[model samples]
Target: MQHLMLVPVLLPLLVAALMMLLGEERHRLKMALNVGSCAALLAVSCLLLLRASHDGAPQAVGVYLPGNWQAPFGIVLALDRLCALMLVLTSLVALAAALFACARWHRVGVHFHVLFQLQLMGLAGAFLTADLFNLFVFFEVTLAASYGLLLHGSGRARVLSGMHYIAINLAASALLLIGVSMLYGITGTLNMADLAQHIPTLRASDRGLLHAAAGILATAFLIKAAVWPLNFWLVPAYSAATAPVAALFALMTKLGVYSILRLWSLLFGDEAGASAQFGSLWLIGAGMLTMAFGAIGMMGSQRLGHLAGYAALLSSGTVLAVAGFGQNLLTAAMLYYLPASTLAISALFLLGDVMDRWRSPVDGADPYEPTSEAAPFLNARLEPTRGFNLDEEEQALVGRPIPAATAFVGLAFLLCTLMLSGLPPLPGFVGKFAMLNALFNPLGLAASAGAQPGLTGWVFVLVLIASGFLALTALVRAGIAHFWTAQGRGPLRVGLAEGVPIGALLLSCVLLTVAAGPALRYAQATADALHAPSGYVQSILGAEPVPSVAAGSTLDETAEATP
Candidate 1:
């Protein structure tokens, strides 16, 4: 149990290294390894979450020090309710994406399994690491893997989009490094717990530099979160990538949100004296703008892929705004919304590929627009085929059955549309309602004298409602064009690999809806833990190094030397 914290990072690192030793021709072995590793990761993440949530435990937070070094001096990894939840979410998405990729996408490129495992390693590390410097290291690892994954298919459009994606992320990485340097120069420690401790005691002269450094650091996170003005690259690049890659990229955006939530709450909570709640209003404003931009983009998008991309942007905006509010209940609701929206959007990405293939041109003509002569049942006249009679073609179509694949695709699309639009009875609607409830009654009890929502709250309500409407309209239009008007098409041959993963994701959404009570309770606990981070701080900083095993040395003697 003590070593479990290391498995999320080490397991993937070891697996990827082993896979790298195998030749590219051994795809079956690679696929098996990828799926097996993802499953193991999901299992480990669940165990961590349970451990973090146990009520009987003295402390739910677990901190690990590599080489048994003390905190603020050597690397630290901490697991609490919030980080544990994120780990579970990351593992779930990765597993589904890996299963879907095994159908065909993995074969399209080289080193895919290796990169996939490395990507998981980075994500796990980013969520677990408790310092600024190692966060940057894990960020690079994740980005490096994503770069190769984005260009896996190697097309002209992918090349162009990949270049843009690479350039922007590289710039963000540079900003991150600079910010880390400035922060270290000012505070003299990079551990987040240590920084939080040092922030309140800083000299008056250093406050300005601290804020500047924090702002630069935030810009990098915002860029990755796809906030407005910095997110123009998201739709084009995401829509151009292959299906499975785009699905995995959904979690990548949320990683930025997680970073902001983790750092901001720890460093700027009520304990920060004059710096408490700094830049929060800016976060709210940016979030609103991002939501509006994403909603408008969704309404105007033509392709399903583009719509899915915009939907991801909209989801990011919603969570960012909610997090900025700094209210415990609102953050809890956003936590529920986060995973639900991510899973639905990922399903949309995978479904879009099948729909696109389903609508491909057959025999150089529109499959849905047959001549009226072929169907004299219609009250219109049209030219007939030169070699075949209209009556014979119509007779040939009389008993043809609708394909099972078509039905499955249409049904899956409908469910995705409902979930994304936040319609009733789905987890999406439950999440939104929870947010609205929390916004109006922030204390989670009867309304008090000054409990009314402010102007920004009302504006956020309007944006949330309007975005759902726009998303519904756009998806309905796409559905009508694809499913309703089609008359004659061949059966789509969906592989079992593809169908099963989609089913599993959608079923998970259903389970969330059914079990909203416990899920919300967990989310509330996570939110509470985040806002009151003393436990997190103490767990990391107060942890002692393991005593050395040198001969003839007392345990106290080995532990007495301070790092």
Candidate 2:
């Protein structure tokens, strides 16, 4: 049971390392290895999620202390319902991306499978780690893998975007290290459970330093979260990547939101004496502003990639703001919204890639060229003639006309737009309704707290409504331009490989809507666990009580003594 907690992190690391040693000529072997690994990961994640959710309270948290060292003394990996859920989501997306890439994108670069595995490893580690230091480490690992993947194809636009992405993240990384150091200096431990226990005991003066460190750390995380002002780099970087890469990148922003939600609730949520609700106002205010920014950006976006990027920002803002509310119902709704929205955006990205390719000219003619034309066209290569050849006289016949793949593209596009824009009959609308109901009903936050939502909360509501409206307007406009107003360049060929992943993603959203009751119940349980983190702390710390002396000791002295 304990060993399973480490599998998510170690399995990917081992696969990535093994892939690195394989030869470039072994493409088929590489593809098989990648698919097999992703399938195994998905299977393991599902089992872990089932165990975490079904097992009894204490048993639900599976904690592994490496080197047989105790908590706060060695690296600890903990898997609870929340971590298991994230692992499942990560593996699902990863598997989809891996399958989609195998269609053709894998040939664009060396080490594609290796880098992909490394990225998954990092994401899993980030979600499961019990210590702040390891979180930073995992962040670096993920970012490094992304940096390589961003420039995999090696084009001018990709290079330019990758440069900006790398530079900004490197700066954020520096801040992360500095903030972690400061927190360690003040609290004497890097374990999240330990930090939560120690924070309430800090002196007033030390609390000021702790707040400053937290502020720096939040800045780094918000940058990754794609929060306003700090998120200028996300649109360009994401918009320029290859389709499969962009789809995987959809989960990157969620990682930041996950970190903020987890750490904020554990360390500061009405628990840290002087620091209780320390940054709630900032979170709500910044999140609302980010939502507004994304809405505006979506309205102005001319490219499909940019529209998807802005949509991601909007999703992040919604989660961040709901998290700020500190209401269990809102958090539950946000949890449901997270995976639903991510899968939708990922499908959109994949669809965009196919659209881009379908519209592209092959040999200065329609990409879907006629197969039976009698003209022996010099550039007659198309989907049907991948490896075969024809004599000049025999190839001189006119190509056979085939129906365009427009139906699949248009239908998928409509579904994705509906999901992204929160239209009725989709999971997006259900999640939004759940959130709005929680916000306005008499039994909700306002009535229970004996207070109105105030100007800010109301503003959040207005922004939420307005963002959805803007998204709808933008998607409608884009849809009409691409599908209704435009003439078909040629008949597009949608391959089974490409169509399957998109369909799976859309189907998942439908399932989410169908199963909303049970899904939301699970989300509610997750929100409860987050808000009341005593169970989380106790799970990590085990039967022994937290050491009081550790709370007062200086981290520098502790560091010196440990070595």
Candidate 3:
């Protein structure tokens, strides 16, 4: 059980290695490995979730030892409910994205499979590590692979924008490194579980300095989360990347949210001094503004790619704001929305890319072949094929009459609506319900009352509702501009490879909303664990066993252990 925690991270890497050894020649072997590994990972995640649910435990913490070295002396892998859930979510999205990238990889001769596997490795590592420094190392690994994928096949514009993305992330890396160094210096511990236990004992002055250090680290996270001021890099990077690359924006930003979640409970627990010192209030404000920015940008934007990019920005902000609500709210919001939203958003971005392909006027193989030398892989397809059979589903959705097949498209709109507006039955709706319920408590009510009353909450609410309205409005406007209102719609070709990912992601999205029962329950457990934090600490480090009465009483005479 302890060592099983490493399976999720190890499997993908081993499979990816197998694929890499096959090289660019055996596409069949590579495909089998890619699909097989993801399916396996998904199975692992579901098993983890089941065991987690059955134990009457929020989740068991599994530890993986390398070369049989024990904890404290060697690196370890930790798996709790949150990490397992993320592993599954990341696997699902990566599978879909890999499927979507299949044609391009075959056509262009790029090692899309290799880049993809590395990306999965990074994501799993980020979620599983028990050490803060290792967390940063994994963080860089994923970002680097993501940068490669994002810049793949786009030209100078993407490279130019990706450069900005790199610059911002590199700065963030520096800040994170500094923060970790300060933390280790002060606490004499790098293991998260150990640090959490020791944090409460720091002097008031040391606490203040640590909090200040945390502020710097938090700023770096916000940049990745795409929260307002630090968010400038996000939209540009998304716009410049390929469709499959853009799909990963969801994963990339969630890294930030996950870090914030981990840090808040692990470092700034009740044991750590003040809530004010953690600076979550500022995060909430940033989220509020981010929602508004996305809504407004959606209304004003003309390009589909940019619109999708802005949509990602707003979603990133909401997660941050909701997570900033502290343990109960953060745990609930993350458990509820993170995976579902990642599904929806990744699907939407992929759909946007498909739409671009369908409507584009570029001739045969132009999108696939790299012509430009500057960013050889960065060359983009700008035009649609002349004679292709567009799917009835896509045709009807984009068509003037809005045919019966439009159900999925309509579903997309509703998913976005429920997600952005925070309404009921939907997971986003219920998740927000959890927050609303949490807020109804004395502490919550106080935060609500003090939440800048009119402007802040109202603005967030308006942005939420308006973004939903705007997305629908844009869909309608698009129907008019492309399907019903435009000229070139006789017939278009549809491929199963193209549709499988979209459909799978869509079905899962609906399933998640409909089946929020278990999800919400799991969420509440996470919330409880996060607020009190004994669960997280115990998971990574062996928990304290209940002491026998005589043993407890004799502790006074026993020597206290010192580090």
Candidate 4:
């Protein structure tokens, strides 16, 4: 069971290597391997989550030393509730995106399966690594894979967006390196736990250097998290990518948020004396501004893809602000919002692809008009094609009719809209409500004295409400344009490959709503563990190498202890 921590990082790497050896024509086998690896990853992540949660009375944290050396001297992987939860989320989203890609996107480009698996490996490593250096390595790995994935279909739009994406990320990577090097020079150690243990004892003169390095590091992460002015590249890049790739990219921004949450709490929490909550004010200010920017973008978006992109930014900003609050309850609520928004945005991307196809002109006829043989109740004929095309000019089918696909797309869009907008009966609303409740009652129902939310809290509440309203208004307008105003579209040919993944994502959101009780409890526990990370630090730094027997030791004595 202790060795299970290595599987998430190793399995995808092995599978990717194997897939690389095969010819590109062997796509089916590669697809099978990729999907199988993802499924296995999901299973392993669930076990890790359970173990971290201590449901089986196991340790709450597990540490693995890759080179069999003691901590601070060797590479380390640490798994806790937060890391396990992220692994699970990554696997779930990756699996869905892989399945959706099997319909067409996988074959459109070379090395798709290999890059996909590598991306997963990088994500898992980033979550599991116990040092700042390895985090930088994994960030580069993930970014490299994303560069290829973004250009999978090779359109002018993709090429343009991909270049900008590459340039910005390359700059961020340089900043990350500079920050990490500065920290190492200042502290003499790159291990996160060691840094956490050493930070509070630093001399007053060095504190300025430390904060500068930390700020530089945080700037890189905030750019990835799409916070305000640094986030100009997100919508264009996301909107231009192929659907399945766009869906997978939904988790990429959240990874930035995850890094901020992890490092901020672990290194700068209350235990850090003078450096406690080092940049809370900056985080709050930037996060609120990010929300306002996203809201305005959402209201002005002309495409559903653009809307989904801005919605992601809004979600990131909301979580960042909550993290700034430094309240366990609010953090728990943000955790809930995190996954709900991710699933919704991913579904919206996939559904937007289908909607784009539905609105497209077929057989040179007007896109809005039905053919002579088309009727409201009849099935429209699908023209067999080599594969799905990304261009609007390509004709894939003809005629128009009402079918189950239309109904499915419409209903799924509604759920996504409601979830993104934080409307009733969904996990989005539930998450926001929890945050508001925590803000108004910081004492969590046990205290007799009533409390008032301060000016910052009130401002946060207003931004949250206003973002939701703008999202709702924007989505509702887009929905009307797609579903009501252009009603005569052909029956959408939603393949099982495409429909299943979208349905699964939305259904997961629904399940989240239904199981809010247990989920919230888990989230609250996770948040509590994050805010107080002494256990995590100890587990990482205190891990010891396994005992070895001397060459001259007797077989019986070695067997008795080793096994």
**Shift in Å, residue 321, candidate 3:** 0.8
lDDT of 4: 0.88
**After aligning candidate 1 to the native by TM-score, how far in Å is the CA of 349 from where it should be?**
0.8
Local distance difference test, each candidate: 0.87, 0.86, 0.69, 0.88
Query: Whole-model lDDT for model 3 versus the true structure?
Result: 0.69
At residue 361, candidate 3 shows an lDDT of 63
TM-score of 2: 0.88
Give the per-residue lDDT of model 3 (tens digit) for 1-563: 45456777788778777777785778877876777777777777778766655665664566665544454546767777777778778878877877776656333536666677777888889888888888899888788777777678858988899899999999999988998888888888788888788777787778867777778878777777888878888878887787777876678888888888777766775566553326657777888788778767767776667777777776777777666656465457567877776787788777766556656563445222334562322223222343323453322112124333344544554555455445566666666555545544456545331222234444544555565576557545654454444444323334567667777886787788788877877876766666666776776667333456888768855756532
Question: Candidates' TM-scores?
Answer: 0.91, 0.88, 0.82, 0.90
lDDT of 2 by residue, 1-563 (tens): 65777888889899888888899888788888888898899999999988888878633467787655678988888888788888988888888888889899988989999999999999999999999999999999999999999998889999999999999999999998999999999999999989999999999989999999999999999999999989999999999998889999999999999999999988887777888888888898889889999989999996889999999999999999988878777888998998999999889889888876765543345544544653245344433354434444334234443344677788889989888888888889989999888877646675331124567667888898999999999988988777656555554768887888888888889999999998898888888788778888888887333345755477657877995
The pairs that clash in candidate 4 are none
Give one digit per residue, the lDDT tens place, for model 4 in 437-497.
9888856722311123368888999999999999999999999998888845565679999
RMSD of each: 5.1, 8.7, 9.8, 7.0
Worst 10 residues of 4 by lDDT: 445-454
Clash count list over all predictions: 0, 15, 17, 0
Tell me how far the alpha carbon of residue 412 in candidate 3 is from the true structure, in angstroms, after superposition.
4.9
